[model samples]
Target: MEEHNIFSLIADNLSQFYEYTGFANATFGHILMILIGLAFVYLAIKKEWEPMLLVPIGFGIIIGNIPLFPGLSVGVYEEGSVLNILYQGVQQGYYPPLIFLGIGAMTDFSALISNPKLMLIGAAAQFGIFGAYGIALALGFTPAEAGAIGIIGGADGPTAIFLSSRLAPDLVGAIAVSAYSYMALVPVIQPPIMRLLTTKKERLIKMKSPRAVSKKEKIMFPIIGFLLTAFIVPSGLPLLGMLFFGNLLKESGVTRRLAETARGPLIDTVTILIGLTVGCSTQADKFLQWTSIKIFILGFLSFVIATAAGVLFVKFFNLFLKKGNKINPLIGNAGVSAVPDSARISNNIGLEYDKTNYLLMHAMGPNVAGVIGSAVAAGILLGFLS
Candidate 1:
């Protein structure tokens, strides 16, 4: 009888192990999230959508979703876990400044310097940030959270992450993912808005060549730009400071080694950490909430509004300009702050309308300006809301 009881106890212990393990404990929502993660991987590998970012992010999602016992305390959010340690860079907003450094190194400001007036187009597009802020507030988010969500419209991922980390750390996962996702979709999203807002004549219109910028202007731009922006919005100095410093390194002509390192290895490392931590932050329990859906909706609306605002602002500007000086409205779509992607879209759309109308160089002015504009907007919101 004792022998029989021992055997029964062993069977009961085995059954408890089977019942308590991840295979049995994981909910349907977890499965759904895992499948969504796999879909991201497919998009990254097969569709080539932001492959550098999405590949690591998708893989991280898969790693993050692997259900583990709470006692193990090894999940992304669990204290003392490796992922949680790595995620501190994101949470503390260190990754964004570094990413900005890389961006500044890669950026060429000659186009923007040659045509400073185009900076207005980038400024006009920022209304989308305020527009989305109001919308998010109406949807019942607090002012701080709303401010974070609103920045997704800026289509600037690092800025989104930076602002959201400060203003709404809880929503950072959804905000970051939404911002990057829309940035990757710039070609699809901006083209339709670009087409609908402007006519063929507007798209075909080409502006005069920008005045040649001097080496002095190139070198002075970073120093002057830094002082102006930093003094105006001290909160933005963390991002803007690093950005201009990196630009100075690139333009200084003597810092080629540092510039190359920032643009290449440093950026690549930050990107991988940003992607993985962002993905891991989206563990199903946190990301499956209604707020995540709301954030995604607000993000999409913000992007569309920013794009339209840019195109229409160009049309508005054309009303004042003589025909010879009028800017191409298509290039205004570059004001959504998706960097070269939006500018490239503007260029491609321009080519389709007028084969000879090369808008790339002109469009780059607003494209880089949008970067500055978005950072400023984030600082404004961070000041007011946070």
Candidate 2:
């Protein structure tokens, strides 16, 4: 009888231990999310698609999906967990402005400054955000959630995150992932649209070289840009302020050290933390919903709309410009603010059509403008909705 009781106690303990194991707690959603994470890793390593962003985010997805026994403090969402603490950077919108500072430090506004008309292309691309806003509303999301989702169309991840965090904190994970995913896929997505939107002659067209911008212009742009933009939509100051500040640090020449730190170590550290935490926030229960699917679809639609709007708008704008000054429609795709990626696509596709037509510098004008335009749009949305 004593031996049997001891055996029964041991069996009970073993059963309880098994209950705490991942296999016991795991669900179909967890497995699905893990597979998606692995796919992201594979794409990063094998395809070299946005490796910096995808690798950290992919690994984070795996970490987040690992089934946990209830009450464990190891998960990202569990209060007092290390991951939870680290996640505050994303949750509270601290990482985006820091990243913007890095971008400003790294960027050269000379392209945009040399040709101010390109700024209009950037502004036109924002049609995607508002277009998506209407669609999201039709789909039944609240004004705030729709506003957050719409920012994904800008193809600027940090802006998407910043806007979503303010407007719809609950949907931040889906919106952030959607924004970054599309940004990373710019090479794949923009080319076909660029080809479809314009004729062969339009793709081959090349404009005159940009005028050289002086040191005074470079140094003054950030200050003037900040005042002009921030004064218009002061709510965007968090992102726009950091962006312009970083630019000033770089262009000021006196602050090379500060610019280097902001563009290099500081940005790298913040990127890893932001990417990982954002990935972790997409726990199966939270991310695998029908709403997430809807967000992804809307995100794709928004990106497509933004790209088309830019290209089509250029075609319309060309009617007003004289020959030799008419912009290459290929560069219009750069208006979505994927930075050098979208600009590079513009250059590469133009190269495919005509080797002599180099559009990189021209494309950079609208590419960088897209960044500013997106931030401004986010501020406007936040002001009205939040």
TM-scores of all candidate predictions against the true structure: 0.96, 0.97
What Cα-based lDDT does every candidate model obtain? 0.90, 0.94
Give the per-residue lDDT digits (tens) of candidate 2, residues 1-386. Answer: 99999999999999999999999999999999999889888998999888888988888999999999978899998999999999988888999999999999999999999999999999999999999999999999999999999999999988998888888988998998889889889999999999998999899898889999999999999999999999999999999999999999999999999999999999999999999998899999999999999999999999999999999999999999999799999988999998889999999999999988899999999999999999999999999998
Candidate 1 ranges beyond 4 A from true positions:
1-21
- Which 10 successive residues of model 2 have the least lDDT summed? 49-58
- lDDT of residue 84 for candidate 2: 93
Clashes by residue pair, model 1: none
lDDT string, candidate 1, 1-386, tens digits: 99999999999999988876779768777787788779888988998888887887887787778777675668889988999999988899999999999999999999999989899999999888889999999999999999999999888999999999999999988899889888878888889989999888788897899999998999999999999998999889888998999999999999999999999999999999999999888888888999999999999999989999999999999999997999999988888788888999999999998889999999999999999999989888888887
Candidate 2 residue runs with Cα over 4 Å from true position: 1-10
